[model samples]
Target: MATSLFKEILFRKKITDDLNVGERKIIIFDEANNGNMGDQAIVYAQTEFIKKNFPTDRILHFSIAESIGILKH
Candidate 1:
């Protein structure tokens, strides 16, 4: 459902192309598989909701399970 919605947004071109050249290179991470506390749940939903809006080749889809970042004290 999320993927479909994103596709719709992209198809309609409703989203603003405000990204810069450097920003475009960044991949939006859904973080569903991640265990970090700082990760925004809404953003995850939004990410999942709008994933298909972007090109598959250019975007890197990552789930919470795939994230393995370690925080140091």
Candidate 2:
């Protein structure tokens, strides 16, 4: 189990290292259009978190009512 976990961590690190901010695209999916404030808040929080952590990566948000849209910084 420990060896498997270590392999997973190393694989993740390799993927992270290969990612380029200019070429990386992150898509966040949510059900915010169902009139749920909590869902909206979660999406908002996630967007903020991603922006904070991956400052240069492109972020896309998709909700139930709308199609794919790019997140503005």
Highest TM-score: which candidate? Answer: 2
Tens digit of lDDT per residue, candidate 2, span 5-72? 43344354354444434687677654376667888788888889999999987775556533322122
lDDT of model 2 at position 51: 95
Candidate 2 local Cα displacement, residue 17, angstroms:
25
TM agreement with the true structure for every prediction: 0.25, 0.51
- For every candidate in turn, the CA RMSD to the true structure comes to 13.3, 12.0
Measured on C-alpha atoms, candidate 1 has an lDDT of 0.45
Residue 65, model 2: Cα distance from true site in angstroms: 5.6
TM-score of 1: 0.25
Cα lDDT, all candidates: 0.45, 0.59
Task: Report the lDDT of model 2 for residue 59.
Answer: 74
Question: Which 10 residues in a row give candidate 1 its minimum summed lDDT?
Answer: 64-73
Distance (Å) between predicted and true CA of 3, model 2?
36
